[model samples]
Target: MLYRDGLTREGIVVDVIIVGAGPVGLSLALGLARAGKSVVVLEKDPGLHTTSRAPIIWPRTQEILADLGVMDRFESASIILKQFTMWNADSNHKLISLPISELKDQTHFPQILILPQHKTEALLYEALKAYPSVQVHFAHEVTGLSQDSESVRVRYATNGTSESEMVASYVVGCDGAHSAIRAALGLELDGITYPLMAALADVKLPYNDPNWVFPRLSVKDVPVVAVQIELGEWRLILPFTQDESITMDERVRLSVKNLFHQADYSLIWQSEFKLHQRISPQFALGRVALAGDAAHLNSPVGGQGMNSGIQDGALLCTALVKAIDTRNPALLQPNAEMRHAKINFGVNQFTNILTRVVMLSKGRYMPWVLRILNLVLKIPSLRQKFLMKLTMLGD
Candidate 1:
């Protein structure tokens, strides 16, 4: 039932038209469809995202996924991380340890899960298929968007070949950083991109620790970070200097060699990235609203990028369902304001501080800083507070 050249005369109309089928978009569709609302998810890409991007799902996000009825599937496909250890790579000593397992009394899913973004999307897509009222169209690129006093009319291309149109009562942009819906609405994403660039690669390492996740930083010669994603696969992040002389593979190899003193690992995936700390001025504009990366983008230090977006989807859908039922679009304003506040005060601020600490960890004062940090974390109440902030359960 895919629409090719424009919609039929008696064409299809839905309660909500969601642009982008990423985790945020898909999560929102699942919530809206389950609430008995007709939903249509439009994705420009032909299939699921395969990259190992955004691998950590915090406890708060796990709670939301549980409400979506897909936690069991995630539990089977992912690995739970009970503890996070930050090491002084130069000295080869542990700087601080955050025990995530101790939070069991505060939450049902007490630990963070290391599941790749692609698998998480697959589970959500499968769950979405059970709803007859929900329709997902792939290779459909949104080209134009306009809204009248009542509904929104979206113009798109099917596989970049033909044009089509679909109208809906509301439209949401869950697209990534370069969101078409956000651009079409003439809104600006304001923030600064850090001068530093990060090189990320997934590799099979010789280290075989299972329950603990390592954040090895402050190596002697190289400034980089490494974290274990699964059993044998690890993700490494280093500053990308854009030196045209050295190949990306060489940079990754050198970083790994410098940190681990071993050259026996195999590369799985690699990419260079520039970090940005930005957020849109407003989350809602008339009948069109933005969520996920479209609404905000922050440092990946705390693994809050995907988690915050999932939270956005869950909260926005609840407000949208009520607004649709009550015939009052103003009900969505509260959600927009609340999400904006959380991103600004909670995610952005926290991650910014973390990025700074990691960047400065190799400085002369880092040893003293680590000692003080270790002492603070030894306090049970303070450690629990830190855990709540990292897990997003504090909100």
Candidate 2:
């Protein structure tokens, strides 16, 4: 079968093969390639665009990117969020406004940087593109997979035209939630989806607050959420428009039309997203392994989806490097068991926080409940505790 470069009468083998070319896969490729491993990335997309989706870059992810020597590039194209403001929509009273200044000196990249996911991917791909050992083939989709004791054989087709096979010592699945690799490996993804389907949109608008994201809290505490993103974009979470068949455009339009009463907002992008908390049963199954959304998927409440994916890229690379350096190479086969647990734990934490926050809006006691929570938030110790949970700094 034809390999990446071309047909090799003599089968070619690589040290690692990565699926998906988003930030996660590109990050993983950079890590493995820098560690002196031969890495190839297969992307089903034709090319990356400036995606307004997932622009929030937390401090931890910034630190990781900085280590990879691309933080400056990212900073050039993003905004740093310094404050989180929560308001009581009824009274129009500011409940609690928290600034990230508290995390100063804690992380090298202390502020939350906002950059479009496409821009982030562009930077990552640029960095990895310099390495001759790493190659990325766009429009290549994995169609089949077979693994043996020694290596993994991946079957892929380009533009639905030709078939090819590539052998690799290991494979990493950084694909999104419905990962083809995860399914091909026969790994079970267990999780529960929240009753509400989220509506996400990006658009240009005139706004006064430069660094604040105003999210609409539950009016009566039913675990529903409506959040505004960046300066112009907004997100809404409500019961699926069809209860069972929520089309992306329908959900997006319904969310906007309901909130704005008129869809005057110019939409640049729209999607119906579901908040699910799920994790693969394992991270590794022999030479094939999973990372990022393939390993775990969660709600976008705290902007943890991409952050966790970046962590997956960084952590998986660390594990792989250790395995490669070990005396027995045979001991290394995608340490799925441990990675799966870590990813699952991360997902649960986000879900729990989101659920609790939503639950606080329930019932007639909301006025008193808000007062109490606000009072508690004023206490420095309590605020710090809350910050730890929200930022996952405690972990």
Candidate 1 per-residue lDDT, tens place, 244-264, comes to 566777767776776666788
Model 2: weakest 10-residue lDDT segment is 216-225
| TM-score per model over all chains | 0.91, 0.83
lDDT of 2: 0.70
- Which pairs of residues clash in candidate 2, taking residues 3 or more apart in a chain or in different chains? 221-361, 221-362, 283-336, 284-336
Tell me, by lDDT, which candidate is best: 1
How good is model 1 by TM-score? Answer: 0.91
Candidate 1 local Cα displacement, residue 67, angstroms: 0.6
lDDT of 2 by residue, 49-116 (tens): 56667777887788888878788888877766576555555455665567677877566665667667
After aligning candidate 2 to the native by TM-score, how far in Å is the CA of 7 from where it should be? Answer: 17
Clashes counted in candidate 2 amount to: 4
